[model samples]
Structure formats: structure tokens, C-alpha cells
Target chain A: MRYLLIYDITHDGTRSKVADVCLDYGLNRIQYSAFLGELSPAHQRELLLKVHQRLGKHGANIQLFPLDEKAWVGRKSIEREERQNNE
Target chain B: MRYLLIYDITHDGTRSKVADVCLDYGLNRIQYSAFLGELSPAHQRELLLKVHQRLGKHGANIQLFPLDEKAWVGRKSIEREERQNNE
Candidate 1:
């Protein structure tokens, strides 16, 4: 299952730690605070638990969103051309 | 159906125009390059065409991903605490 992970943490130390954890799980960084990857339900739960441990009592919030195959087709992205159009 | 829109454009003018179009469709900005909202299939297709029109021959890419109800509940987010934790 494809998943989107978005997070907001108070501590810089913990925030980067979360990023590393997500990368360790093979999730791609879509944005500074967002990541995307394919993981099993069990894997997803495991990552959540690990993130929770890092969060500790800092009161940070982290969210995981599942994106099914149908949703995958619905994704859109735009890449700009290298050359500029004067017109 | 919930949808996520992600885009990259060469021109600032076209980029902001796209953002306005997304807002007109009632989508929320989840990030600088991403927007989220619920749209019907027809509406989804309609928005796609409008976005395409805006692109013209500039070679910008825009993608729309459909997110179902099952996927919505799978969303996760974190909010930081207001107070400092000395401990």
C-alpha cells in the first residue's frame, strides 16, 4: 500500500530523526515535511511506533495516510521546461 | 471522491493561476506544490482539462490523484505544542 507521511515536530533534533526513520523505511521525500512510499500495514504500524518513540513528551504530531492504487492514478505533477517561452 | 493535486510550472504567473483554479474548486493547500479536496469524477475530469488549458505549450506538468474515503481516514498529521518543555 502506498502511504503519505506528514509531520510537525517542535524539536529540530527529533524532526530530522523522524526524516531519517522515514528514509530508513524507504519512503521518498516529496517535501521537507512530507514523504511517500509503499509499505505493508504491519510496516506502517511499525514505523508509527518508532516515530512515536522519537516524539516522546515533545508533543509533536505525525500523520500517516494510505494511498491505494486508485489514488495513485489520480496523482498529478508538473515539471517546468528547461527553456523559456518569450511569447 | 477526495483528490490530491500536485504541480510544477516554469512561470510564476501560470503557477498562481493554477492555485486560484484549485481554490475555486474548493481544494485546500497541503503544501506549496500540493492541494487536497473532494471532487466528483466529472469535476475531477473538468479540473484536469482546465489545468491543461492553463499549461498551453509551456511544457508544465500537472497531476490529479483521486483519494477515496477509505484513504481519507488513513491520513495522519502532527501539531506542535505551544508551551516549552524544560524536561
Candidate 2:
């Protein structure tokens, strides 16, 4: 499954630190502030725990949305259209 | 690319009504309240416009996230894990 992790850092310094931690954990930064990654439920749980441990109370607000294949295709089509428009 | 549209209705009736319009617009309901759909930029724009026009001031809050193929694959992997665990 694919997961979109959208998070807003509380401060600029925190964003950089969070990004570093995410990179270390095998997650890729998709947008400026969002992450795109693949992980099993167990891995997801581990990832969240790591996030909390590393950032502690200073961690940013986060929302994770899990997508199935069909939804993924639909989102991809929209992205293609957006890219085409931008080009 | 994949897109996830997450929305929260103001009331129960609004939820049912929004679901109906989403069904009419070639979108499938993924969660009880969320929609999964493939749409081009033009279509996305049109969809939003229609949603606004139909629901007017009563429309629910909506957020759309566009994803790339890689992200979609990742998300799908997570969903598979979740489903497997459920089964």
C-alpha cells in the first residue's frame, strides 16, 4: 500500500530535522512538506513510533492517508494532467 | 498519479448526498466517507466546481492530494498489509 504523510512543522529547524529522520527511515520526501512511502502495517506502526520518539513533544502535526491500487491510479492520472498543464 | 479526496460532511444527510454526487461523477467511495477517483486537471476543476455549485454553502470541507506512481505503489503496499491482517 501507499501512504501519503502530510505534516506541518512547528518551526523551520524542526522541518529539517524531521526530514533527516524520515530519510533515515526509508521514506522519500514528495513535496516540500509531505512524504511518500511504502510500509507494511507493522512498519507503519514502527515508523510512527520512531517519529514520536525522535521528535517528542515538539513534533509537527501529521495526517496519514492510506490508498489502495484503484485510488492510486486515479491520483496518478490527475498528477499527469497537472504536470502536462505545467509543461 | 493518484489522488485522495478526504472530506467531512456537516451532517449525516449531507454525507449521503455527497456520496450520491460522487457516484454520478465517476468516483468510487473508498472509505465510508472518502472518495477515490481518476480525473484530469480539467475534470478535477469541473468536479470541484460542480461540488460547490450543487452543495453551495452547505458543501462539506474537502482536501485533494495528488500522487505520483511511486507513491501510489507504496500506498497500495500498505493497504495490502492492512487487508491481510484484517483477513
Q: Which candidate gets the maximum DockQ versus the true structure?
A: 1
Docking class of 2: incorrect
Question: If you superpose only chain B onto the true chain B, what TM-score does each candidate give?
Answer: 0.79, 0.72
> What are the TM-scores, per candidate, against the unseen true structure?
0.69, 0.47
CA lDDT of each prediction against the hidden true structure: 0.76, 0.59
Q: Cα-based RMSD of the predictions, in order?
A: 3.9, 11.4
Question: What lDDT tens digits, residue by residue, belong to model 2 across residues A1-87?
Answer: 567665556557655776776677678875555566776788777776666655544535655667556545554211211123234
At residue A31, candidate 1 shows an lDDT of 60
Q: Write the per-residue lDDT of candidate 1 for residues A1-87, one digit (tens) a residue.
A: 999877667578888889999998999987666788999888888898888777766767666778888778767665556455665
lDDT of 2 at A41: 86
DockQ of each: 0.47, 0.06
- Reference interface contacts recovered per candidate: 0.68, 0.03
Model 1 chain A is weakest, by summed lDDT over 10 consecutive residues, at: A78-87
Candidate that would win on lDDT? 1
Score candidate 2 by TM-score against the native.
0.47
